[model samples]
Target: MLTKPKILVVEDEIIVAVNLGQKLKKLGYDLVGITSSGEEAIQKAEENHPDLVLMDINIEGNLDGIQTAELLRNRFQTPVIYLTAYADENTLNRAKRTQPLGYIVKPFESDQLRSSIEVALYKNELEHRNRKNEESLKSTLNQMESGIITTDENGLVLFCNPVAEKIAGLSYAESIGLSLTKILKLEDSTSSSYTLPLSDVLISNQTIEKNGIFAVDGIGNKTAVSIQISPILNTEGKSSGSITVLRLGESDNTNQSYLKEIHHRIKNNLTVISSLLSMNASNLKDQETLDIFKDSQHRIQAVALLHEVLYENHDLSSISFDLYVRKLTDLLFEVYKVDRSKFKLVLDIQTPKIPSEMGMNCALIINELLTNSFKHGFKGRESGSILIRFSLNDEQYFLEVKDDGVGLSDDTIAQTRNSGSLGLSLVDSFVKLLRGKLKLENENGCKVTLSFPTRHET
Candidate 1:
């Protein structure tokens, strides 16, 4: 239910005050109190917090009704209507300065007084709502991440948010009344003769956006930023002002930093797992079981190394395959305890960089092939050479691993093809997972060739 408007009556005459109170009650208004003096009227207004004050110009006490109304308006924003017998030029002029909402001469009718009071209350309510909305709008703009600035039709700055103040290198007080160009010094990063399209936005009454621009500060420092300017139209659908929004273009740096941290954490976790496997393998006595643990450790290290490379490099999407292969071979040679003078390893890698997923698969495949050569093919040989070659052609990758050692016999080759051995079985599975073809043969020793289409082709 809606509450009736509370009204406070201030009049020196006892009859007039009582009559006004009765009139308010008849009109469905709540009578807060009646006072004959200005000082008592202010006290009543302060206590009651009335919606409207019917203040008489000629009241008792040292403080008159006009002075009391001014104080009430300044302190509590209370709307007032003048009820006075003095309608002379001097009294009316003095009353106007107090800014009363309505004025009623002596001996006024109930209808006239009601009309004035209703109009004042309606206007006051509208003003209250407008002030509330403006405060809400300011709060929202202040909390926004992007810099927001509003300017008049002449491009003079009217308001700016905290972000705008920081980006422009100026305080809110300093930015106000300054021209838009004075507050914001922006230029195209790729061109020198570029100018802001503020005029176009205002004249055409359309939003204009520019990216890859540099925002220059007062101290001659430039920040990469993007901006959008939109016209603020009035009720007549004409341009009244403009709103400019500024956004930093280098926000991607934060995302890249996060990605690097994620890669580093993944690499560390993988390293820990590899270390655990190595520890378990140290306690194993059986040669076959020990070799299996060691192989698992090496495979984990392959993926861990890829993450390590990604963490160290600026590009997180792909890695230098050649560099990765060199590191992996050195690691494998050290793990196998191969004498540098007796064993030779040759790497002919033509592919520079490949996606991380593809690189991980290739790394594991190479690990298997090299382990097989060091364990079975070179088993009893004091000296041997292994060659690993990788190249790209016709939207496909070719990888060849050849070793000059004891070659697999026809029966052994047939058994490996049937997935008789665990190592060879894994190799077959990996080749099929890559959607590639693999060939195993004996050319001077043992040779394995695998080919797969590029990642995009699949």
Candidate 2:
């Protein structure tokens, strides 16, 4: 009189079959087909189309329960649950390979059977939701313009979307599971004094940030990237791993030309204005007033030259030291016009990536030292050799200018404390900005040495 619940029961034993059928009926479920062999179960499942199949692993025929479930799954998409007497791991594992919906060990309670079925259904629902979420996440990540790379506890890259793989010049399959240092060629980035922030995410389990020049691939591409590495905590609030967020863009270039041009124009205008002031000051009797005007003009010109040079460079971030040095030497040549036999400026240098402010400091320091040589040391002749040596002195950079003409007197050395000359005072000021030491020795003519720490490595 009851509405039947169709089911296929696959068991090799007759007693177990009769008991399972009786139990399902007592639980208000119908037994549609009961078979002794896997061959019969598959045949019955194809024809009967039961709601579920209770399959036994050990059967009477060539095919086992798992094999039969696989065949039924392929043909009818029907879910299978195994009811086996043996709890041996290998037999259970074999049954699991077919992706059975549930498994029940024999000598089990009726509730155990119900629980497995309920849990299996719940897991199936969860898996369906997870699949949809995975598809959505993958689509969004692929559409992103920037890169996204996620790492595991070991710092090995676990996930890299399309953009990341493209930027890194590797396939997603090849990039995943590879250590970040080796893959990004960041070995050299941390090869120097600085350690890359990505390395810290796995160590201290803390978020770290890094911003500077990252010359991966080569200097030609030279894309600037800001990286944020944060620890990924599991549900238990423990550090499971880290994810590195990278935002990349080109470095500042527009400011380069603007800065240089503005300085160049200002320098030219100051030069003309200085000439007018000098002519007017010359007409006055007081030499002190004339000297004041000259000092102000020189200070203005110093800042002006900095602007011109910066505008010429493509990268506004820093300056080219070699070019700056040559420009100053040329300006000194025009001012003093020191003959080849008098004070010749010799340049010996080896360093790179000088900060903009530091490079300007270098220019002003050289200008002061060179001007002093012409005014004091090289007073006798317009031609004398002045050796300018720029050497790397134990992690520091040093600039030494030496002249072989007339030496400073003992009185000149003692009296020249702070205010004796504007040249010496300016040199001291620029040295302070560079965080360097400035010393003037008058043993044989005069030698000025300025040493400072480099902002970047060569």
- The superposed Cα distance between candidate 2 and the true structure at residue 404, in angstroms, equals 86
Measured on C-alpha atoms, candidate 2 has an lDDT of 0.71
Steric clash count of candidate 2: 8
List model 1 lDDT by residue over 340-405, tens digit each. Answer: 789998888767567767777787888888888888899999999999999889889999999999
RMSD of each: 27.2, 28.0
Please give the distance, in angstroms, between residue 255's alpha carbon in candidate 1 and its true position after superposition.
Answer: 7.4
Candidate 2 accuracy as TM-score: 0.44
